[model samples]
Target: MSEFVRLDPHVIDEIVAICDTTLDELRSARRITDFLAIGHNFGDFESSKQLAAGYARKGAGTPESARERVEQFIEALTQLRDAFASGGEAFLDAQFDWTRQLQNIDIDA
Candidate 1:
């Protein structure tokens, strides 16, 4: 698990931008890992791995390594957002169940 350090909103936005970037854009002649450092200490490694596996199963253009790091980045950013939205304890309490809730939500309604 990562330390409980609350990042600034601007920093979160920057991290999210990295996650939203495509693999090619992320690499830009460098390694994808370079842009993913912000998420390395955000914890939830298992969830990140699972999300990466899903991305791999989809046969996206990105390589597994890139996808894994990107997934971790995205998930970590999401967790941070949740923590910011609610209190930290509330976010932690519901963290593991969040995906299920999101999947079941009726966004079109």
Candidate 2:
């Protein structure tokens, strides 16, 4: 036997709305990461230069930095939102098709 699954459109809409709000907040947070990049100091002591470089590495200079991580999160969330929206549309289309098929059945034939 085949299993049937049902999803409430209202729930999907709510989830999509939540994702939108979260994405916006994350984008704003991502902008803050730009301020984490510390510039090099040529007129300072060697220790100061080292410290600045260290801070940069831990902040936004490296590929594995916080800024990059935030960008990855944003991408993942966007994909999730797209998936849910598309899935909801597909579900409605399938429901319509099923209803049409059921209405066309000719039991007397």
Candidate 3:
């Protein structure tokens, strides 16, 4: 026999929104990191090519490991939200800052 757990539909929606927002933050972080790494103001062809290559070389994170971590976090949050019937969604929202988190990161360090 197999065991199954059920989650609230609304919680599922919140989870999806959180995942989407998190992915967007990750992408913005990557763009900012790539720009900082390149450190060029000009839009010349060579500079553009170098910037693209730099991004490829300095990937945001290793694909498999990054994916696993993201999935784990989402799963954990899903469980917590399901367990906390009161103010769970609000708590999740409070923890995630779609834009402010990116601005707060200190890439220069």
Best by TM-score: 2
Show model 3 residue runs off by greater than 4 Å.
Answer: 39-109
Expressed as tens digits, the lDDT of each residue in 1-109 for candidate 1 is 3535455667656654554464335345234444443443445799876665554443333434454444544454456455545434345555556555445443332
Go through the candidates in order and give each one's C-alpha lDDT. Answer: 0.49, 0.66, 0.49
Per residue, candidate 3 scores C-alpha lDDT tens digits across 1-109 of: 1333445878766766775666566555545644434535546689787885555445434432333334444444444444344434444443344234434443432
Superposed by TM-score, candidate 2 places the C-alpha of residue 91 at a distance from the truth, in angstroms, of 11
Clashes of 3: 0
lDDT (Cα) of model 2: 0.66
Local distance difference test, candidate 3: 0.49
TM-score of 3: 0.36
TM-scores of the candidates in the order shown? 0.27, 0.63, 0.36
